[model samples]
Target: MFEISPTEWTAILLSLRVAIIATLVATPFGIALAWLLARRNFWGKSILDAAVHLPLVLPPVVTGYLLLLTLGRRGMVGAWLAENLGIVFAFRWTGAALACGVMSFPLLVRPIRLSIEAIDRRLEQASSTLGAAPWQVFATVTLPLALPGILAGMVLGFAKAIGEFGATITFVSNIPGETQTISSAIYSLIQTPDGDSAAGRLVLISIVIAMGALIASEWFARRATQRLHGN
Candidate 1:
């Protein structure tokens, strides 16, 4: 059936909201980390790289449990935040966003790192010789040249956030109209009697969203390539 129920619509909207927030919140940090990995050498560089990528290797449930321990209401950080700042993450949509952001962070960093690594150092050297400040050089030259990769990273992160399930449900417990995302809703639907049709609809919607994001990413990548080549 082509009809989507109100609950399904809520889940869809909530998924979009969480994905967008996660992407926006993670982007600046992603760029900075990508730049560091691409352009700088430092103590514990390997450790940092491994840490950034740890999520990809670890079970999502483990990540979520770790987050709960560190950021739940009674957690060390969470308690301090709640006491001092009235902020709470456990069982909240904000918590879902945080979980999504953490899970997708590596996706947001890899493409940008590759792009930055691909940049010609000679171009940077040339800019420095022209007396451009480091910040100015990065803002004007490095960032612009790396825009395509940054965009790609954002899209990838967004897609990852949209589909995130294990971490989100573990951290926030899939509360409807709050933390219940499309994936979680579909999961709930699948467990109910005669819920196959609703579950199927959600699956179709998920496919459409994922495909759209992939198409957009590819189109943007092509456009960026064309622009780079002055086509």
Candidate 2:
């Protein structure tokens, strides 16, 4: 029962690929937004913050439908891209990644924002006084100080991406070997008469992956604290 089949392996691998891509692509944006929210006080800041966290509160299916309407083949942006750039997001693996990224973005930004907020600003001021350029100060002092939160956020985002189902299936249609991920696979499996064992296996794997991510986040958090305390 524990032996995995080819199709299951495919789903597992696809899930990993989608999650990793989503996390990596979203990280830089997450960091930038996190910093902006943490450090800046521009107009419409509250609105931007609310928008960032909108996915977390919105129903996943609603979010997916919004993506489809905006990025679907006939969508304004989607049509322009398809015409000018020959790119598409609807009913594709890339769509799956996009959906996952949107779904996980809030979780990705929160920890990083909190970490940046927790930073002692005097260090940044001191670095500036020491003739460090703004970019240099951020690179040397701000970024390093925020590393742990960034890592934690990445892991959390990856975890969310891997398990994403509603948005992924809605946007990408769960095509096997194309857009089917572990969550969608399990969803399909449990609906079939002879798929109980397979579904059970996938469930177990999901549990393992989630637990591992949580543990890793905790470790990163501890490391961050230790580093901050110079221990």
Candidate 3:
């Protein structure tokens, strides 16, 4: 195998950073959304679900373009943020994380929703009868019982963030050391001459990362399941 370059190393770090940011920020919202979808009956619920999952079905490039329009310097929230907080997302790593997070939200929500749905309602009722507040019941009972699916969802979101390309490149433009994640770096290398070596190295890294994510997800899932069931 060829020795990895500093550029590649930076890209690796950036990729991990983006994935971690996306997963951590999205996980809490994922759990909340999952709970809402699983336990609540409200008007336009189907529409809410579809809107949340839109990124999964829509073209990632299209999603990126939309972000550019809505989050660009002159765009609505973007303009306010720049004016008030002096922050920018256009061509920034934060923008890359936003794109990845939006794209991976559905993946994080799906498994969590399934787990929430699987929870036995009788347990929650019994907790309520025993004088546990709703928040207490959720924190102690529903959340604990649904931990396995939440873990799975987080892992899946991280994997998706690591592999995110289209929306990231569209929103962040693949600036080295800022937004040039592994997937974007690989794409950049593949477009030039004598780039095969670097591309190959990145490809291997991608596989390893993917496999590692799968292994981690399995580990968390099993551990959570065991903790919940104690069998």
Candidate 4:
């Protein structure tokens, strides 16, 4: 898309990878936390709820820095990972994915939690009454009921992760074909001389991708809800 270089395409591709990885990594935890927050009664639940949403309200740079400190090459967890698994996150694409994941988590959880809350607990109870175990009931009843919400959350999180800038950059420096994403590429173009033409191209592509994701999610969610209601 860029006028002078392959940077724009590389950035777009890397950004897509980061967003996909982040969404996949966050899905299980998002569903679990959403179920817990919506269905469980426990002490300090509000605190957990607030913590889940902390990323949404906090400065992205702050979150990125925290991730760096905790997961950087020499940081505690990072040290262990390096020593044990020979894996490192600092300035890596994986680190960028982590940053995007953290930043997008709140958006992922909120809608799923609301969906979980909307589920009829009675259906789960009925499943249990029919000799289904807790896990079985959740799998068969609760999860099916919550599909639409979960889909919405996933779509939202993926979109946010795709657009993540501050956290991604702060945690992982923009390295072309490594950690450089569309947002970072766009930012860089905006800073360079006569870069507006290329920037405009990338922006149009970004808008199309975003609109596509939104439309797909809307259709899927509606169809899921309709099927569940019919059942």
Most TM-score-accurate candidate: 2
Model 2, poorest ten-residue lDDT window? 222-231
lDDT of each: 0.92, 0.94, 0.93, 0.88
Using TM-score as the yardstick, the better of models 2 and 3 is 2
Best-fitting candidate, scored by lDDT? 2
Worst 10-residue stretch by lDDT in candidate 3? 221-230
Pairs clashing within candidate 1: none
Expressed as tens digits, the lDDT of each residue in 1-231 for candidate 1 is 589999999999999999999999999999999999998999999999999999888999999999999999988999999999999999989999999999999999998898888777788889989999999889978999889889989998999999999999988898999999999999999999988999999999899989988887787677667655656
Clash pairs (backbone) in predicted model 2: none
Residue 34 of candidate 1: its Cα lDDT?
Answer: 100
Q: What TM-score would each prediction reach against the true structure?
A: 0.96, 0.98, 0.96, 0.94
Clashing pairs in 3: none
> Residue 98 deviation, candidate 3, in Å?
0.5
* Residue 177 Cα positional deviation in candidate 1, in Å, after optimal superposition: 0.5
User: lDDT tens string, model 2, 90-136?
Assistant: 88888999999999999999999999998899999999999999999
Q: What is the C-alpha RMSD of each candidate to the true structure, in Å?
A: 1.2, 0.7, 1.3, 1.8
TM-score of 3: 0.96
List residue ranges in candidate 3 displaced over 4 A.
223-228
